[model samples]
Target: MLPSTDALLDGLLDWVRIETHTPDTAGLNSIMDLVQSQAEGFGATCQRFPGRDGKGDHLLVLSPWGDHAQKGVLLLSHLDTVHPRGTIEHDLPIRIEEDRCFGPGICDMKGGAFNGLAAMRAIAESGVTPPLPARILFTSDEEVGSPTSRSLIEDQGKHAKYALVTEPARNGGHVVTARKGVGRFTLKVEGRPSHAGARHWQGRSAVTELAHQIIALEAMTDYDREITVNVGEITGGTGTNVVPQFAQAEIDLRVPTAEAADEMVARITGLTPKTPDTKLTITGGMNRPPFEQSDASKALFDHASTLAAEIGFELVGEKTGGGSDGNFIADRIPTLDGLGPDGDDVHTLNEHIFVSSLKPRMLLLKRLMETLS
Candidate 1:
């Protein structure tokens, strides 16, 4: 049997209290320690890889049942959150407000991770062996993009037949079947600098060149094609009295298809400086490939939807603009994302999960583990 809602909330709240910011290695390991202990207590063997490149450690826990050599379920969750260290103490405290439980990292995915473990624990206690073995990989860096853990996740994906990401569910319990590819780039403009008052004609303003380029970049957004290019950050100029010699803008790109990603990348990278004598440089490329819906993924969603209905709820699949690690393995294998608890206000001061969703979502995950072959 699944645990009571109150009991599950108690376990999940314990995790919310820990501030595991993406860069806080110690905080991340603290939560991972708890994860390892709980997973091992339920007969899962865990492998701990130390953090590198100023990131937190990652935990890989394999189910006690099934052969270690077999290709099985890959359960993914990131322990690191975007919230800072003192978010809980100052901003979003652990409190039950009506049906929502507000806390730092509660909905954005610590809740999902905890409930996943709870489902496994229930299975272990009931003496039921899953049809296929399960491996839960708790990663540390995902909020700032999985810089250090991406390779590790892909390596693990090679041995897995199915990938289920416990990212926060969307649009009221909708699992993600597709996501836009994400790309980041930096555009730098270099120009001749001179005193604005003394030699305005001789100097080329890097900031002015950057402004023109920004307009061109923003104009690339095509809602019809589901492509967006945003120049999110810009830095330029040294003083008001001097013409700027250098300017830089950070660009964000999203596309719904691989072809769109390639096309947009070429367009962005091939930009030529409009201002004569000013040098323009572009750096960076696609970080995640688009997660297009596939037949296998559709079948997986159908199965999950059936399970959700049996558990007394309807589950839907959505295509989101946000990218997840699901993008990494969706093309490689059958992948279903946003299996986490239903919630709203993710990555905000009011971030929380619906307390009522705890039991049903847990039941759904438990059933998937038992029934997915």
Candidate 2:
């Protein structure tokens, strides 16, 4: 059964109203407190892990009655929003008009967190046990790729039988079964400097050499294999009259599979510049590994889609170039993500969540959790 659509909407409204940007430590803590209080009221046991700054914390809520030694499913969410603390000054005070709910972080994730709590709350109120012993992990820093909470996510994920991440879906209403790998690399070059007007060949132009490497990298992109190498940022040169002594560039690559990732890494690391006059230094590696689909994950998706079909919506899946917390967990265990409300224009003022989808997705989550046992 699905959660009451009206109740889910009201809960999401309260959630987005809190300015819980992880960077804003105070705001993050306050939001965590609000959630902690709510979970406690549901009789869920909760614990907080504070960060280095003593500001933000990761909240873990467990089934009220469970054996500590046994591992079970872990549901993941984050208490932080991507917007700044003051974003509420403008697009805040969430408004629900027709089929959409507009606000900061409404669709990206906060809505998903609400669904997790609702499912557990429904069970708790009914005095019924969940499908299994469960763990709800609410992290603090997901927008920036879980810099601090990543190890903890993997640690808990390894113990659980399965993991569910609540990142929003690409299409308006669906879930993710796989995601491409993401990598960040820097290509730097050093050359001799001289007066361009007086001595042309006396200096090796680092900028010129960097241009060759950039072109070479771009040439490696193969659409057939779904590989993309993007030269996102470049900086070099001192003056028009002087040969540039140093040049640097940032590279972003997205690949579909581990084999593709390995192939790309080797090719990128061994890039030989056309101009040997400049010394090339490339430093960077895969930050997030690919969340390739596995047979187990596919079965889980089938189960979820079956549940969705039983409800009312046709279920489908898609592959995304974007990376999420799911990528990190997928490396060790079967994971499914992109399970939040539908929306677009995240990280901008125009961000909005489909008001109509919120309740349905919550219902989806509720039904799925019940089946997990």
Candidate 3:
């Protein structure tokens, strides 16, 4: 029998009370405490991976009963919530009103994490320990792109035959099949400075040179290939009277292909100085690798769909513009994501999770573990 929805809901409320925003060390620790306490009850072994000190931390829990070399799944979810420190701590009450459960981090991840534990428990009680293991990794920095935890995810991902991510599905519960690769770029332009009024002819404007670069950068965006170049932030001149000596701007680029990522980085980094009077510098590279759907991923998706069908949910796939830790692991192994409870308005004050969706979704996940045998 599957675990009760009441127990899953209680566990979700327990997790949401922790307030694990990445920049808050205390919050991260609180989340780790919550995770460890919960996992320990089931005889699972928990480990803490200290993030760059003062930058928060991540937690990993391995159920002692499964084996990886045989054929199991790797479960991934983030512990960190985007909420500011102390804002949601002990304040976001878990409520079931009509169709949804209202609370911070409930659908985004905490609810999903609880479901993973529940699924394992269901497996254990069924007296069917699969030949493969299901490894759960809950990172604290996924809200900020998992910079410190991607490597670890990839490392564990390669060992598992399948990967299941617990990120809320988009378009009303359609799972994710593909996502774009992301990159960051910095543009620095330097030029000769002179009094704007006095030696105007001898002066070269760095900001003026930057304008040309920005235009060139924007033109590089190819909508046909789903590539975009955005100069998001800029800063420059110190005084209105003086010619600016330095100007800098940050560029965000996204591509659908790995080769496109390489091409974009090379071209953006090599932007020639517009004027001999200006020197330019560009830095930053690909962050999240593009998730190109492959055979392995398709197989896992098929399996998840089968599980969802048993629980009366028709599974469908969708493409996402946003990146997730799923992209980090998918490239290395068979990965399936967007399997968590449905929700909307993430990163906003109105964030919410579907109460009705929890039981069905949790049941599907519960079977995902039991069927592993």
Candidate 4:
């Protein structure tokens, strides 16, 4: 039996009350405890992997019927949000306004996580063991690039035949079949320092060189190929009196394919300093590979489309420039993403999910889990 709206709302509200900011491992651990208890209530055995690099640990919940040989479905989600601990109390309070539920992280992910849990419970109550076993992975560092959870996500992706990411549905109820690869690079320039007023001509301005590099980097953006480069942050110079001896630029890169990622990295690294006295060095490369559309992914989308129609909602797939752990898993498996409920104003004080979407999306998830192999 599917959980009632009151029951679902109560649960979601409870979850939204607890804030699991990306850097708050202790808070994340508390929420994971709640999620573990919920999953275990549905007969899923929970496993914990300790977090690294000061992030919260990860939880893997395996359904009672899961077996080593099944190579089943992987349901992916994250517990961390971009909001800090006090947002719930200060900026975004828990409130139900007409058809929407307002709170931080409510639309960004907690609502999706709640719906997913509800679907699992419905499955358990239905007495139908799915043809494909299921593993639900709740990661803790996704808001900050998923540094600790990437390897674990990939390892599970290798075992699963299909992956469904419960990220919030995009605007207009579109699911994601593709996501751009995301990466970061830092360029540092070392130059000779001299007194600004006394020996300006003797000094090599690292800031000047970095400014030139930023222009060059920004020019690398190719809208036609869906490639973009941004020099998002830069810092240099000690004081007004000093000609900076060192400067650095932090760049953000996005690409539509692995080949594009490689080519962009090469281009960035191959940059030659126009200034004679400065030496430049580059660091960092691609983080997540692009989730390009594949035949297998398209077939998966077709399966989901039929299931959505049976559930009485039209479904469509979209491509996005943003990257997620979905990007990490898609390169290895047939991944279907954005299966979460509809929402708007994600990652803001106005963040909210459609209250009306909870049950239908839950039912849709239940049907897909029950029917998909």
Candidate 5:
């Protein structure tokens, strides 16, 4: 049975009501229950692998028509979101204003995930056996860089012939073909502390050293290769009257290719402390390699575009600086992303999905999955 618009929206609302922030193991498991229940209803077998670092277990649902022994299509998505608890009740209370449905994670993910479920449902109801095995992997961590789920994703990518990611469709209905690689880094500086008034010259300020590092890091951004280095967060200092002895900075880096990523990391780590007495420590590296578009990936995109055209819409692929779990899988298999319903303002209280876009997106996904061999 094709899902009615009401049913899809109802499912999206039901899933969105649960706040499965990245670190909330219980919350991620709870949302997985909802997802697994639907998958099971379609005759898919489910397995749960325990997560590390206090995250929820990763859930895998295999269609009865497919098996791990054979290569097939992999549906990739994350169950966790960026919004914390109380977002639904206090911040964006679930509401529909004309064509837009406003709620946390609705656009960023939950909506696209619901499309996955709906597509599988339609295929199962049609009773058409897929030519190859199909698998659905629901990870508990994606927003936090998939630290725990990286290996699992890579393993699955190795077995799958293709990967379809449910990250939100880019604005203007563009699908993602390439994404910049992501890296997380921390910079710390240690210096001698002294009373600001009593011996200002006697103290080397760590904060001052960190400030210089931030400038140097920002200067590393190269638009030519789409390399961007941002010091997203920083902390230091003890009191107004004391020269700070320690300071730290958290950086976010994105590069267009793996070679550029390596070069960028090498340069960042090679930085020298300006103050002679200050000691600097740097940690963390690339999280996901860039999703470079290859001929195989382009072929997959072309197929999806053809399928999209059948649904009466022209699909165009674009490169994005934002990274997804697709960044991990794309390098391994033919991956096509941004297969979710169109939406905007993700990671914010105003996040929402276009209510009108849900049905067509689901249909498109259903067709693509059905066409997979």
Candidate 6:
């Protein structure tokens, strides 16, 4: 049997209390230490990868029941959150109101990560060996696009038969089977600066050129094609009386398929300046490839849905625009995402998970670990 709802909430609170912001190496390592200790206490062998580029360390814990060399089940989770350190003190405090356990990272991911650990611990305690070796990877840089941990995740993917991501369950306890590819880019415009009043004809306005480009970029969005281009941020100009010499805009792109991703990339990169005497420079590309649904993934979800029904809950698959580390390995492995606790208002001041949903989700994960062949 899984832990009681209150017991599960207590464990999750322990994790939510520790703020593991994406870039805070110290705080991240602190949480990693807790995870390592817990996994070690449960007789799981662990390997720690020291973080580089000022990111937090990563932990890989393997179940003691199976051979370490064989391809097995990979449980993917991340410890870092989008909220900063002081978020708990001011923005979202740890509190239980009705059935919701409110905290900074509880809903976004920490709850799901803790549930994965709890399920593993229960299985270990029950003394029933899983059919396949269970490996849980706790990564540190997922919210910032997994920049430091992508290679590590992919390396493990090559050796795994199935990948399960503990990202937050979507819209009322739905699992994710497909995700759009994500792209981030910066566009810069350069032009001659001159006093607006004295030599208006001699100077080119980079801000004006950037504004035109922004309009064109926004116009590229096609809802029917499932492609979106957002000029999220822009900065330019020094003074009102002078023509701007430099301007830059940060863009975000999403595509539902590899073909769409390639087409959008070419379109965005092929931009030219409409303004005379201005230079346009673009940098950056697709950060994550599209996780299109496949036969293997569909079969995996069908198994999960069957298991969920047996466990007395309805399970469905969803395709989200947001991407996760599951996007990294979905094409290569049978991956199921959004296996975390059900919650609402993730990555906001109101972030929280439903206390009632804890035990059922834990049981679902435990069953998946034990029964997946």
TM-scores for all candidates?
Answer: 0.99, 0.93, 0.92, 0.97, 0.97, 0.99
Greater TM-score among 3 and 4 belongs to 4
Candidate 5 residue spans exceeding 4 A from truth: none
Which residue pairs collide, candidate 6?
none
Which candidate comes out best when scored by lDDT?
6
lDDT (tens digit, per residue) of candidate 6 on 201-279: 8899999999999999999999999999999999999999999999999999999999999999999999999999999
Task: Name the runs in model 2 displaced over 4 angstroms.
Answer: 1-3, 53-55, 91-93
Show the colliding residue pairs in model 4.
Answer: none
Q: What would the per-residue lDDT of candidate 2 be over residues 268-307, giving only the tens digit for each residue?
A: 9998767767798999888789999888888778888988
Question: Model 5 over residues 1-373: C-alpha lDDT tens digits?
Answer: 7888888999889998888989888888888888888889878889888888898889988877755699988989887989888878888899999998999889889888888877877787789877877888889988888889989999988889999999999986789999999989999999999999999999999999999999999999988868999999999999989999999999999999999999999998888999879999999899888999989999999999999899888898999999999998787698899999999999988999988888888988888778877
Give the per-residue Cα lDDT of candidate 3 at 305. Answer: 91
lDDT of 6: 0.93
RMSD of candidates 1 onward, in order: 0.8, 2.1, 2.3, 1.2, 1.2, 0.8
lDDT of each residue in 81-135, candidate 4, tens digit only: 9999899888999888899889989877887777877787788877888888888
TM-score computed on alpha carbons, candidate 4:
0.97
After the best TM-score superposition of candidate 2, give how far the Cα of residue 220 lies from its true spot, in angstroms.
Answer: 1.6
lDDT of 1 by residue, 1-373 (tens): 6699999999999998999999999999999999999999988899999999999999998887888688988889898999999999999888888999999999989888888888888988889988888888899999988999999899999889888889999988888999999999999999999999999999999999999999999999999999999999999999999999999999999999999999999999999999999999999999999999899999999999999999999999999999998898899889999999999999999999999998888888889989999
lDDT for model 5 comes to 0.89
**Model 6 stretches astray by more than 4 angstroms:** none
Q: How do the residues 193-279 of candidate 3 rate in per-residue lDDT, one tens digit apiece?
A: 999998988888999999999999999999999999999999999899999999999998989888998899999988998787689
